[model samples]
Target: MTHQEPPRGRRIPGIALRHRWISSVMVAVAQLIGTNGAARNQSGRVHLDALAYVLLLAGPALLPLRHRLPVLVAAGTTTVAAVYLALGYPYGPVFLSVIVAFFTAIGAGHRRAVLIIAGTVYTVEQLLVGHWLYRWLPPAGDGPTSWMTTSGIAAWLLAVLAGAELFRSRSERVARERRERAEAESRRAGEERLRIARELHDVLAHSISVINVQAGVALALMDEHPEQARTALTTIKAASKEALGEVRQVLSTLRAPGDAPRSPAPGLDRLPELAEQAAGAGLKVDLSTVGARFPLPPGADLAAFRIIQEALTNIVRHSASRTARVRLGYGPEGVELSVDDDGPSSPRAEPAVSGGNGLVGMRERAAALGGTVEAGPRPDGGFRVLAKLPTGAAGTVAVATEEEGR
Candidate 1:
């Protein structure tokens, strides 16, 4: 789906200048033969006939320049032939130059001019050869068969013209479609980069800010509450480390040349770790699972993880609730993840310090996976976050608890 420009001065394979040269030589020979025979019959002398044939052959050399200056070449050759006709000379192969010119005009996207010139030249040639001049100096034929012969020549010329028009139209349409497709792809890539940038800013910024606050709290309490300070320091270290990993993962997408690429991204299997981390940050995160244990797509996993992480962070910072629940359920059609906190449920504007990037990032992620997400307060005095993602197949598996008859 990519186009590479060819090197300068390199000719395309089928359209080489050599083919034009060969065609010009062949057409010249054909003109020589046609004129030689016709002039001999018309003038009844060998010397004068040879001169006419030479003049006709001279016209065909113009064909080699048709690709560069099609209209000029056609006009010049046709002018020469028109003069020859006035002198009562024979029909010549130089007429082929008009066909070559029409072909070039069509290919070069000048169809209107090509049609006008083709119609004028063809009409003039028909009038001169078919009726007017034929009555005065007709070819050696006794029947209507001569008329058929002349008509056939005109039809063949028109057919070549039609073929050239078809080729040019199709080529132009294909080129237009290719350009449109490339533009669409460019727009999609730009949108994707913007989405990635927003996610990195939302996720890493929020995590690092939390880590910084915890570190500051630990420092402030070190001399007073040793045990509490130790816990705060531990949470600070863990948050900072996780922030570094998230930042590195985001930055890894922009790895420079010569850097070894990282492993494939995480998926749903890491959701439990995310819940555990939220619990460590002084939130009681209860985890639950339902249905199958089938593998989830990488995109689905990352989206689910980010959704849970944001929901927990919101609960930690905004709600007075100490307990949050994370739920995962796989079913016959799709997978679903939901987080709920039985905390202060009164609706309020999102914290000014963090903005609303978390909600935007979550919506963007879900949309990319062809999934759905909803975040709102429940009727039962709690906040809720829910997401549903389609799975390729339905599956079944055993579910286990941390201490099941151990």
Candidate 2:
């Protein structure tokens, strides 16, 4: 059998729920003891009276309402205790209920000024009533005015106030921590969702662009050039298959309860495949490396590859460019990547759709790794994109040597 926790605001069986009954029983016991002693008086036995019994039990009986009406309950209980003491009744644990109510008031978020007022009123009432009671029926010894009695009373009151304040502060701190943790979790979830969206956009956009171009080519040559159309169809099949695999990989990461073997993300090693895809789409891509190559951090590597892919995809879709060049340069500080296309500049040369997110995604990826990207129409003609990424100490000796040479 599974036991589910009750929702918030539902009452649970615990100390708080039983506090009233427990307090009532304690007050009854104290009253019984004090009354028994009063009855043993040799001068005259103090008889039990209905009004005295009612006043003595009033404070304890009201303990259960402390949580709902803390300040009011505290004031009520304190008044009852003061009146009971003033009536020349035997003093006992009547003040226990007041202390509990004070704690409830503090926990309920009563202000410092209100607490001060309550404390002052309660102290003054107790002092006035105790003095009158002492004069009316002097104790057998030093009485409540004795140093020990005064010090003990002061210490008990201070202890109750200090304990209540400490608990209030602690509860507030715990609530603040819980809220902070929830906000942090919310931010992490948002970032994860954005990462997934970026991955899907990159995968789908590039593959679909390639397939779209290949499908167009196949349709254009279906009758006149059957062999080339078949090749175009093959390219479409390959691009779609690759896109499906990448999409599945992204989805698998989100799946719970399964430990599927994870695939390493694409990086610079996939540049040749990207070039081949561009070539199949009728764009000649020439890739070159400079200053040697070094291993990059996983995130940096993926970001670099995606930036290059998005740049090339844009060229295929928007620029009327038939040829493009990709250059990779490594240095101790970071890796630099640039893509230049020899596309014709025309009013219709830009992407079919306005305000595409390709550049935004590229910039976001690079900026996340302390890198930057620049893209604009070339001074002479066509368009160009350049990106610089920071690699830190993880960069290999090739990068260091290249930097030294520079």
Best-performing candidate as measured by TM-score? 2
- Work out the TM-score per prediction: 0.70, 0.82
Instruction: Please give the distance, in angstroms, between residue 348's alpha carbon in candidate 2 and its true position after superposition.
Output: 6.6
TM-score of 2: 0.82
Give one digit per residue, the lDDT tens place, for model 1 in 287-318. Answer: 89886566666667777777778778778667
Q: Judging by lDDT against the true structure, name the best candidate.
A: 2
Off by over 4 Å in 1: 1-97, 107-113, 133-145, 226-234, 254-261, 345-355, 396-406
Extract clashing residue pairs from model 2. Answer: none
For candidate 2, which ten residues in a row score worst on lDDT? 137-146
Evaluated against the true structure, the overall lDDT of model 1 is: 0.70
Cα lDDT, all candidates = 0.70, 0.79
Task: Report the Cα RMSD per candidate.
Answer: 6.9, 4.6
In the range 40-142, model 2's lDDT, one tens digit per residue, is 5623323446877887678778877777778788788878876765555555666777777778788779847336755676566456544445555533332
